[model samples]
Target: MSMVEVQPGGASGMTMPAAPKRRTLPGWAIFVIGVVGVVGVLATTSYLTGEAALTSSSTMQNTVTLGMPILLAGLGGIWAERSGMINIGLEGMMILGTWGAAWGGLHGGPWVAVLSGAVFGALGGVLHAIATVTFGVNHIVSGVAINLLGAGIAKYLSTLIFAPLSSNPRDSPPIERFDTFSAQPLADWLGELEQDQRAVISDVAGLLRGLVTRVSPMLLITILLVVGTYLLLWHTRFGLRLRSCGENPVAAESLGVNVYLHKYVAVIVSGALAGIGGAALVLGSSPSIYSEGQTANRGFIGLAAMIFGNWRPGGTLAGAGLFGYADGLRLSAGPQTVHALLYAAVIAAGLVVIWQLWRRKWTTATLAAVGAVAVYALYYASDELPREFLPYTPHIITLVVLALAAQRLRPPAADGLPYRRGEGD
Candidate 1:
């Protein structure tokens, strides 16, 4: 005989038991876990390959210097996209900025260079705004036009302005470098600790040392901008309305928001930021010269970084850092250190397989497992990657990151959509 249990308050007033709550790690815990994992991977890779550069202070220093321009460009993308415009002309704006910075530096100094770069970049933004917002042209078309126009204009200006000064049509004369400061005592202490080479402790010391030593004022300003962007876009009233235009402009217009004004401002600011990025490239380099093609498609890379970050300031910084690290490794440490990275990738892939299996994603787990095995086999067979391939490492990283993050990406609902006043009404 089967016995039936009575429901609460009998059948008429039955209630189901509460479902179990899912557990998740807190933000700080997740951050700690990530840091620990990274340290572990680096330590293991260094030990296995006998490569000290993998976690050296110099490598970290180079990472910051190289990553700053990309970070600035990514920030510019964030501003325009957040306000409902896709500023694909960021590349063009940056090119203009490089020329502006060089010209300004030659006449005045570093600060003048920064200001000139911003102004030039803002001018590019104005062109974009007029084409996309005022005229209702296709955003992509407008952006491409800006890119071409920017290149042409830069070349023309260089020939007219820089040729007489530098005796070369494509190169600018030397510009003043930015002043840098360091926490010398802290740097010295960390240097000694890094020299000790005590696994995780030494690695952490090296990383900290890079940050405290020979720090640029622009780096501080960039950090402030990142924080400022987060606060402005998420916390302030103006930011809300601007973001609203991107999400639903008709509704925003109905609510008395000046969508056109906000879009124009956003795009202009975006250009200014991209211009600063270009300036950073000129000033940060050893010789402080603006050469033709110096932007090196970093604007596009910045766009990729913005997407990798899912259009957030903090995320953009992380994306830029990753790209910068790959680039720095290639430039500073060369092939042997990069080869050591293969071993670290193998371990990371193994972790991915385990994670996918735990989630019961059989296809993904199988793919990850296969990938891990394949990477290991490659590591076993190859000594080092070709030097020629090193230059593309950052781009490769960008592609891989975009692929991994594609499923989670969510752009603004009304982004890239043309808006005319009264249409929402």
Candidate 2:
């Protein structure tokens, strides 16, 4: 017997023509283009404003350090979201991890501190899983509750445990921090190249020098985790099952995948990663110690990064780096450097307008044109931005990035949705 394929809302055996495929650049080409564009912008800004910090090694070093926590938190967000859970409580878990790391560092050492933070964060994950998966609590409500509780608990613990040592309720005693290493001959060679200041080559040298100089072991681990996450999620059988749960739990269940187990595991891992992020913030500081409000809402920033990256690991890293770069620029080079960046923004906006026009997106092109004009006018009008507003550079960048990327994002089908076993049946 022969079978005829039936088309939906059409006669039997009828098929629709396939749509034409859109041409797109390969990932590597896109990456190279982005890198070259960024380098060129920095070079131009530095030359225009005569601010060397715009392309300095120290600035890039600060960017890596500042971006690490955000990257970790973003990774945590990815883990949870990919498994069909929204983790707004990453901040809370990070708070808990900070306390745990401080306490562990004082009693044991850096490694112990790391372990303690992970365990504490995992506990928070367990609580969230119990509330949302088993008891059917709203994910947002549970996450908010976790945030409040985590903060409260951390404060109380700080008073009870750290007050005696530090004579302060908000700060813990100093703990030993991890050591950093630099590549010897390569670092020296790159430093020399950076000093020579030969346009793009020097800028590239400076960037590489910063990466190799004073590098923390944890930073290396973070990079490994990013690459590992990509491999695991896209390549592994277990990852496929977990992602399936997020995409369609009912379908996953029918296929003998344990959706609840996958979600629980994913969320727990999420908390652990966020916890590590907290530990990174603590450890990355001079005379590392936990302090109240030290997290500075980096957890939320990280969530935003995850969204901007469209839930991919590589994209998340880029988002984190962008935010980190904005923050590092302000902190390392001050307002003069930031003022110079306005020119970069103007150029970027102009490029966006051009690209939108090329794509025949009239409305988007018009918006980009308006934005570019406004930014250019501001650059022309001001010598420097107000110092008070300078601190909010990273947050402002986050909002801007999300707004631009919002239209392009494609989240998992069942993300943030409540799930129950056998509901589809």
Q: For candidate 1, lDDT tens digit of each residue in 107-160?
A: 999889888888998899999999999999999999999999989999999999
TM-score of each: 0.93, 0.94
Query: Which digits, one per residue and each the tens of the lDDT, describe model 2 over residues 1-425?
Result: 33446578766777555656779997567767877788888887777778888888899998998898899999999999998999999999999989999999999888888888888888888988899989989999999998998899999999999999999999999998888999999999999999997877787888889899999987987898898888888899999999998899999999999999999999999999898888888888777999999899999999999999899888898899899899888888888789888888988888888899998999999999999899889999999999998989999999988998999999988998999999989
Stretches of candidate 2 above 4 Å error?
A: 1-17, 26-29
TM-score between candidate 1 and the true structure: 0.93
Reference-based lDDT, residue 17, model 1:
53
- The TM-score of candidate 2 is 0.94
